[model samples]
Target chain A: MIIPALIGSLPRPVSLSKKLEQYYLGRLSEEKLEEAYREHTRRAFENLRRAGIRVITDGLYRWDDIFNPLIRFIDGVEVNGLFKFYENNFFYRSPVVKGELSLGENPIPEWLNVALEIKEEVYPGAVLKAVLPGPVTLAYHSINEAYESLDELAEAYAGVLAELMKELPVELVELQEPALAAELSRATREKSDSVSAETAKALIERLEKVKALWVVTYFGTPRGFPEGVILNFDLVEGTLPENYRGDLGVGIVNARETKMERRDRLVDKLKPLLRKHGKLYVTPNTLLDFLPESVAWRKLKLLGKLGGE
Target chain B: MELQILPTSIIGSYPKPRWLLRMYSLYELGRLPEEDFREAVKDASVAVLREHERAGVDIPWDGEMGRSEMTEYFTAKISGFKFYGPVRVWGNAYFNKAAAVSKLEYSEPLVLDEFRWIKANTTREIVKVPITGPYTIAEWSFNEYYSSKEELAFELARILNREFTLLEKEGATFIQIDEPAMLNHPDEVPIAVEAINRAVKGVNVKFGLHVCYSNYNLLADYFDEINVSQFALEFANRGFREMEFLKKLTHGELGFGAVDVHNPRIETPEEVAKAIRKVMKYIEPERLYVNPDCGLKLLDRSIAYQKLVNMVKGVEIIRKELAKEGKESIPFRRSA
Candidate 1:
């Protein structure tokens, strides 16, 4: 069965975006802001339900990027300079690891719990997936003064994430590792072994607490993946992995562009792969956060149409 | 063109007044007509130019009042682009993101009208026209047309070449191509430099490249390759840290950012002067130009004005110190 799913974040509606801005500016009260967030959360779920996206995200409306709000919850990390999230215009604060890593007050479970409650009310029986920044990507983008190597830092992050994932009451979690493709590709081209497949696999292994896990990589040519991992390949900047035995995510939707995909063309491309892969979910190659809200919504609707076909 | 040593300027864009923003909202809602909206923009541009003059800025543009976001504005004018709406660049802030849908073509001059308006309005001998650079425009936009990203950038560069040549023909002396996205991909720096060179091909104007909030060290290797007279970089935002790279700068003048525009806190003349003093250890004052870290559009208008006042005051402090060494002023070097 084919299912439509968002890879990372769905663009926040303009009204909610304004409210968030006001809340950050200290113009809006937390109570009122929370009310707005709850209302927006329901709207997002309703939109997804109406569009027939079964495997849904919470829209990650509160997140600036994958690193943010989560980084704020982690000990020994300070938010630093804004770095571009891959080649896209969207930027996230680079996390500076100044001390040993540990979980502080994790708000992911709380945020996800609220989303799940809303999902139950708004779209009963819909699968709500929790999205987190994968350890390898986080370690690569972060400034690491505290750790000996990026692998060590990634492992440290996996320990923190393992603890956090245990708290999340969700069946599946999508760990976004764009660096797995973009950075690693560059590293390989330059003959620098900055991050290794073993390191990434080790990090994923530690997160066995989650009921199910999917590693989504995007933005460049993805190298080797450890066996038995449910992998999502971004077909836009990347190709499907060779001879992989797992449930595959067919990321046929172009999340980076504003152009609407022709459903017929996408189906033709996916037909051969669809027959081969046992379990497949149709998704965007990258986060829709790069596209305009209207464009992203249209893409999601297109994904729904593809899934239905 | 001749100019004073340590000449003060803004890195383009002054904060739009609240009234102008309201006018913009009304204009977008169709409450105000296009003619009225154009007039309002003209009024705002003139007002900001006067403000820059009063703030003692040596070289200023029309505050970029006519343009909304840099790349979006250009995309709207050029062919083969479509806007989907605004995308968030950071917390609560967004810019209208566009996608290259087909082969990019130059239908009209992009910044010439604004350049003509600012040139007529400002009393300054040179107005720094800040066009969003080709590398940045291609990098920021979603490319659906080009076979490769390099092709898209070069296509943009060809179109921009026409725009820049037009501006130069219109008696514009200086053009600061804003390429904040240039250094994002270090591997693509060669293409970026090539794109910039292609964009400025045969334009023959004093060119400045304003790159903000980036590791300026990356460009140090390719500084001579890029055909620009000045490298306007943001330093104040990072507390003027990591400027040891300045020692490697072999060619062109440096547009030193003395005031931090992202922060709301007002900087003192002494503080700005101290930052200038710290930077002057690597480069001489004659080759240095003082400006804010980036566009002042993010700051409140009053705060933006005051920051410029302090920036000019800071430059004045450095000017006095340079005068003590008989290096008071120098001719503005017109070639890269």
Candidate 2:
């Protein structure tokens, strides 16, 4: 009865002014932000632990952005200016991969160092989890300058991330495939003949190289989930379509709301499903602008109960 | 024949009242003086229903005026979520992004106390209560709960469905499930549609699904699977292309967003009229209704008022044009 709990990044709430100041001042010097971020990350983990969350993550507090640092690991890829995704958020743009792509001096060691520090200081005894944006999503969202095909870029990204995963120290790795569900159509639209099977195969192959992989998909459907990708993973994490097979991670709680009582029923409904999957994970819907600490703790308690921790 | 007005369907957008702004500011500032904020929000909820009634809006939304962020309000009420901090908006629309927050639980069910309050205050023909759809809730948030995003969305949908059922029992005639994120991630349409349908399953009320501009090129095909009666879409600000798609999709009444609520530019009655006339060519006048593209929160009170006024005038102009041509008058419908 081991239910999976959020051992991944929970959003960090920093005011706009602070975020800007930090971003502009080049204050991302590990020593400065790391100390404060580690403290914040410790508090988040402690809260989850107290709420009975069995697994934990550093909340990705140390990373300036999810894509940039990793892009630095790939050789021949010039980091371009950051693009503002929609509003206040931003991500680094990578130059196109024209030729043979390979990993530069592995930046995984630096990432792993941060993960290890968070594990040591934050959620000391809890199962550590690491989150990386899925390769397909990264390739899709990134600007492809010199590449003739997205498949080529995706393949390159897969190799880079897989290599990074091999070097990182963590019990479980959650590769967020959010873009897969929603962006698949775009991928198909852009490269109709080469999108689906190619993207799915590339993802599945890359995921196989990792030890404990949870291929997480969100926002839209990845035409290949239950049929294409999920079967290949160690644990298929996400709210599965009613028709999906294997394990279940019932995401019944909403991250935007301030309440918790509504999630209780979600836990109850997921119990039978969890039994079928051998384990279940209760998660909040998504990270939004406001979530009261009390509600988060309650969700962790439920996950703890389900996991028999 | 009095237009055979039997209320064939329902649609509307979440109305963000002025008081909700104050509450959000307070909550964002981390000084919500507890009792005061709650009382004000409750009052704001009542005001939302009243405003819709005054505007003759078909489906009355509680305006989502009571909550700071649509979904965060509930998570805060529940015990699992932790208040991480303000949400960061990406670019110029930075102010529009509800401050960032985080959650940690998925064990408690949402209580419909606010819904019950809205239900108690209104005696209107049919109140259309709005809830943030599960997919939008999941996409908008920083997820830490489940291993994947879909799982999180589905779980939220289940919870929302429970609330929706309860609201229906409490006298809601329609539910406008808002999911703007659907535009950002079109691939999740099937998953979102399923979650939404599941939430409103067995509930007898008319379900009005509202999705904003996320490249609605495939809207015709997408609408074929969703079981909802009316698709109250944001067409005006996004453009007239979506209307053509809706016309081809189905003959069902479309709640066409006629007002540009996002931009501060107040559309004049003439401009609104011209826009309506243009869209009416594609959509039968009888099956169209005027509304703002999305919520009015982003606009100032005067701007929203002008936008709505121009919208009503636009509809009036279209009505006159149809009458002159011996066509049937279009009944009023809500928009997102």
Candidate 3:
């Protein structure tokens, strides 16, 4: 049955965040830090299950934030150059591709293992989702000194992602391409439509082994994409009746703001639209990490009430 | 013979003790008393001042000890500004944003207590007071009262003017208005400049404006009109990319940044010297005051302290060489 699912990255409590920062500064041990970070996944999954949601993500507690760990795992890409993350105060380290971009051996699977442990602990054999940046978002964010063109860079990213997906045990994976939104870059405005569509199609084809491939667009309304996998647009771009057919992840909650919403109100918003689609999953429009931890928890509970069986 | 080549100064705010942050949180949660909070803040300011003295900063400020943020902290002190809640900056990082619901007023000089503490604790004759510029305070905040952003900024400027005027009257030698948002809102530079001019009105102290992580080329035309004695800007963060922008400045000396504050890799004295050499190409050493690219709040205390030490060491390397060449630093100027 259709249910509530996470886009990725649950809100990290400020105390935990401070611990992580301290870990980076060598004030805390690796084992203790992992324990702290991994403990949150248990709570995240527990909250998910209580919300009557089966499909979930690890909440990426270990990820130094998205676009990191992923780009840092690659050999040729040096994590340099800080770009403002949307209008947010957070800065993402831009991947500077000096040479060939290939995935290096890392502990990403181990992170997945921690989440899988939580899955086994409570909701045994439930679908666990993994979120990664889409090829377009990666190539778009990168400063390429080696690649001949952006198209080539996107292709390289696709090949690496396919490899990662094959190795990981995630039942579903979401590609977050918020950069497809125009405000990020002017070049995105003029070129993203055609280039991103091609990139998304190419990536979807490459990741044939993954159980489900979802391309989630946030921040901007993408005009269109080539048909392949489930396309999840944010509240701004997502609607019912006309667009819903195969499947839809209805973003019933706004993730950017800290306003708590009622479950009944959300269910009402989705009730009419849910029937139109062959499958529908309710979700927040973007990462819940932007909101306060308490507010995020309340939103998750709201999902439990509305998206529940 | 010129003044200390690359006279070192902080871009305000040193690494605060973890206890102060904890106490502030406790105070917010109503677990700590006001007297204890104030005492802790004064102690933090004293600690930061001692660190600056040890690092040999020529113009050290009070370290903005009780400041939760540049905007919200000051806004909390000001009348008519109300905070809704914290807004996310990034991973687990947030700054509580305030909205000017009523006309902003300079209810009290909030920094007076901290300034008084700095005066009592430190032996230094001159102390830099870095306040949020009207444009930045307006730009950084959510405006619910003012008709336009320009109007909000102007009103904020009037408030800041009252504060700075008090600081000048109380014998402040150097006052730096931090406008990190200046280049971010280029469309309103003229308005921002006017607001800034209004902020420093009738203040006779050596004024400085701190703007970091920005393209300085954008401010060329507006430089002379900014009404400040110094422009403290970041260079090491951009790999010293915009060094040529300094030559376009018609007024104000340069508060050149040599250390990269955001990076944990403590830059060597040689690395600091190399960055200063690039700045020397655009402006004379006499007009240069070396500092870090930005505040070292994000960095660890050890890293921040060492970077400042290395920055001073780097300036000493060049200073020694200049002395060998029969050039000595002139007496430090209180104003341009």
Candidate 4:
């Protein structure tokens, strides 16, 4: 059976996004801002349910950006500098490593609880998917002052993520690794030779507890990878491997673009994989946050329809 | 194009004054008067000229302070174009990439009036005007009018060529066509190059083509093929890695960028000279022009001014070395 899933984030509504930005800037009251965030998350989950997407996300509404919450949870990482998040116009606060890594006891569990409560009330049968930056991605993007090697830093971060997965009730874990794609964007021509196969294999071994660990690659396809981890690939940029016979996760819809792909077209495109794999995950090529809120939801609906067909 | 030494100039654009940026937004919203906004623009341009003069630049612009983004600045001036919301290109870097819905026609002279203003104020006989290239304008925007991007870029080339001829009539000595997106689409380079040639075909002036934040190696193959007098490219950001590509060039002056605009740290005069010296090993000193990697718009005004000052001083260091070697003032010719 095909699973229609959101890789990460439904686009926050235009007005709500504005308010959240203001909230970050301290122009808006905290009470009022939290209300806005709650409102947006509710709408995001409902939007997912309407699209018939059984695997819903918490919309990552509380996240200021991808690297923030996780880095905030970790002891050594500090958001003091800015680094380009691939070739995209959005920037993430560069996570600088100051000391030995530790996941400080915090309220991250409570952050997902609100969304999980909303999910149970609205779409009872829907499986909640939690998204995180892959350990290799986190380590590569971070300024590792304490860690001696990239693989070492990756193991430390992956260890933390593996622990968090146990505490959360997330049925599916999607690791958004756009950088894993050989050529992330037009501006980025270099191959991602940073994440070694050994480190990826080690991280996958650590994440064995994650019910279904889907390593999602966007921008372009990973030329090579560790074998055991389920690879969620962008169908546009990703080619079906000839040798690999495993559960495949294919992203048939493009989240960055405004153009729509019809369900029939997507169904035809996914037919070969559907016949080959026992379990299939249908997703957008990248995170849907880049698109206008209306267009993103429509694409999700198309994905859901494709999952059923 | 006989230069005794390495001449100094800016690629295009300077940092906009905070007040000017505010007025630009306010005026667009009808909160501020057009007269008030235009006054700020004029004042800002004057300030830019003064900064260049203070830095002792041989060739300078009106600071490209009159416009905001390179391509969209033209979009605002052209007819039959509808602007869209901000499209993110990199982290926190968004440009309102517009599209041409109908046939693009000039409602008025594109930068003629602004050029006239800068000319009236400056004593320099030679000044350069940089207009966004057709290929970049087409590439940056969503195309609705033309069947393909190449067709749309050609149409833009025809439109900009009209302005080119007009600039020549107005006695503009140097003109630069900016195609920062040129390397982004390599397969379309020939079409883009063709469109560029059409834009300045008959107009006689020292024409340059500028590309930034891209791999210069991708462009080395067709350097001589490009129908332009100069190739103004950014190298400071890449730590001057591809300077070896200069040895392959058969013709045209190289606008060598010595200051890093992407980073706020100022490169010292000695450091900048070292970069220029690396290029001199491949090309003659007379063929090299000093400039920053790209526009200083993303940087602070203080950083921009200091960077220009240091860059101008760097050229001075190389000028002395060139004079000692008796290679200065060699007439510009095809490199053997």
Instruction: Give the worst 10-residue stretch by lDDT in candidate 2 chain A.
Output: A228-237
Local error of candidate 2 at residue B155 (angstroms)? 2.8
Residue-level lDDT of model 1, residues B66-86, one tens digit each, is: 888888899999899987788
Best by DockQ: 1
Question: Which tens-of-lDDT digit does each residue in A1-309 have in candidate 3?
Answer: 357777777766666788887987789999998888777777777777877766678887766567887888898988875555554434567788898878899788778877888789977745787888887778777777788778788888888888787777776788877655532442111122234565656565566455468767776676555255676767744443375354567677777554466666776767666655646777788877666566677777776566543
Over the stretch A1-309, how does candidate 2's per-residue lDDT look in tens digits? Answer: 654467334545453235435755586564665566556666776776676676555565544455556666677576653332321122234344545567888655665566667667756777776777777766666656656677777777777777777877775676666556645333122323243565655565556656576666554344565332322121222335556675445455554444344446755666666657765565544432224344545555655655552
lDDT of every model, 2 decimals: 0.84, 0.58, 0.75, 0.75
Model 2 residue runs over 4 Å out of place are: A1-14, A17-309, B1-33, B46-58, B77-83, B92-111, B119-124, B142-148, B183-186, B242-244, B325-336
Native contacts matched by each model: 0.53, 0.10, 0.14, 0.10
lDDT of 3 by residue, B167-214 (tens): 877777788889877765545678989999999888888888998765
Which residue pairs collide, candidate 4?
A88-B90, A89-B89, A89-B90, A89-B91, A89-B92, A90-B90, A90-B91, A91-B91
List TM-scores for all candidates, in order. 0.92, 0.52, 0.82, 0.78
Cα deviation in Å at residue A179, candidate 1?
2.3
Ranking by lDDT: 1, 4, 3, 2
- How many residue pairs of model 4 clash at the backbone? 8
Q: What is the TM-score of chain B in candidate 4?
A: 0.95
lDDT by residue (B216-322, candidate 2, tens digit) is 55456767677666677776654454355655656455667777655678887787778777766776666665667777765666566566656666666666667
Interface RMSD of 1: 4.2
lDDT of 1 by residue, A237-304 (tens): 78886776667886888887776789889888878887787458889888877888888888889898
> Residue B243 of candidate 2: its Cα lDDT?
51
User: After TM-score superposition, what is the CA distance of residue B268 in candidate 4 from its true location, in Å?
Assistant: 2.5
Interface RMSD of 2: 8.0
